[model samples]
Target: MNSSVEKCHMFHESAVDLLTSIDFCESTLKTSIFFVAFNPIFWNIISRLEYYTHFLTKLTRNPRTGCYVLAVTIFSLGLVRNYFFEQALYKQGVTGVLQNEVAKVLGVALIIIGQVLVLTSMYQLGIIGTYCGDYFGILMKERVSAFPFNICENPMYRGSTLSFLGISLLQGKSAGLLITFFVHMVYEIALKFEEPFTMKIYRNPKKD
Candidate 1:
């Protein structure tokens, strides 16, 4: 009876430790996710502000050059966001049994599909179109209704969300799953601001 009690005590302690570790990991993951979600929103707001103010153009002395600089800045921020996201994944504990061989395969497939949509959209848009050049008066001749775009209104955002979900599933990280939902929420909010502004730009040629 004493031995059984001792064994039960040990198991309880182990479970407590496991829970503590998971809590720590989740805290770190939330911080990482905040940065990932914030970066795009920050840049989008700043870029739109720049467009309205012409501060970037004044600083650069050329609208095209200013747009290019903003594009580079946005791209760099994206890289940083990805780094934080990866770090969060690393910190997360793999507690789910569903992260088996099948999960890994599904994750890889999702990543591939997401990349295809992203790359194809980029190709269709070119560097300027991909990076909000339209806001800077570098507008596309017309809307692109190609493979990815036709399939989804916002392929880039959807693809990115899918990639995040895929990675979370691949690693079987609960923290990652939560982060993915946060990512989707942030993108949805951004689109609410973005789509209307973009449509306004196109509708009023005077803005361009």
Candidate 2:
């Protein structure tokens, strides 16, 4: 009986140790995810504000400079977003939180559809299409009623939002969903601020 008690105590200690290690791992993963997620969101808000202020004005000026600035802004955003995305995946992998075969297929499908919506908008609208046109002051053509534009009122913005969600699901990262939510919020704000101003710009011009 004494021997059995000793063995049971030993097993208990071993189980506690294993659980402790798992807890440590979970803490590290959460911390890592938080750090990676922060930077892109910071830059996105900053750049989006700056970009909107300059977009329309810049558009009316030399398109070369306008394009350059747009490219810089978008590229910067892409890099940061990618890093966050990578970190989300890393955390999920560590936690074994990813979806299995069925989810994998669904995630892939959403990703493709979302990308199509986004890229279609870009292709139909060009650089100005995917970005806030207010910075350069370059109004898009009178109409953008084509491709992805037809599918969603703000295809570029919605597509981007979808892309984030799709990628997150594909990566099996629950944190990715939160990040995507933030992206959508930001884009929605930008859309509300930007779309009317642009419509007015083009609309007034025709009236003149």
Give candidate 2 regions above 4 Å deviation: 1-61, 93-98, 204-208
- Span of ten consecutive residues with least summed lDDT in model 2: 16-25
Each candidate structure's TM-score, on Cα atoms with residue i matched to residue i, is 0.84, 0.64
- For model 2, what is the alpha-carbon lDDT of residue 201? 59
The sequence of per-residue lDDT tens digits that candidate 1 reaches over residues 27-103 is 55767777777777887887787768877888989878888898898889888778877888787677544447997
User: In model 2, how many backbone clashes occur?
Assistant: 15
Candidate 1, residue 13: how far the Cα is off, in Å: 20
Q: Model 1, which residues run further than 4 Å from truth?
A: 1-27
Model 2: per-residue Cα lDDT over 96-186, one tens digit each: 3344666567778888888888777778877654554433445565686867666668776677677777876676565566567767776
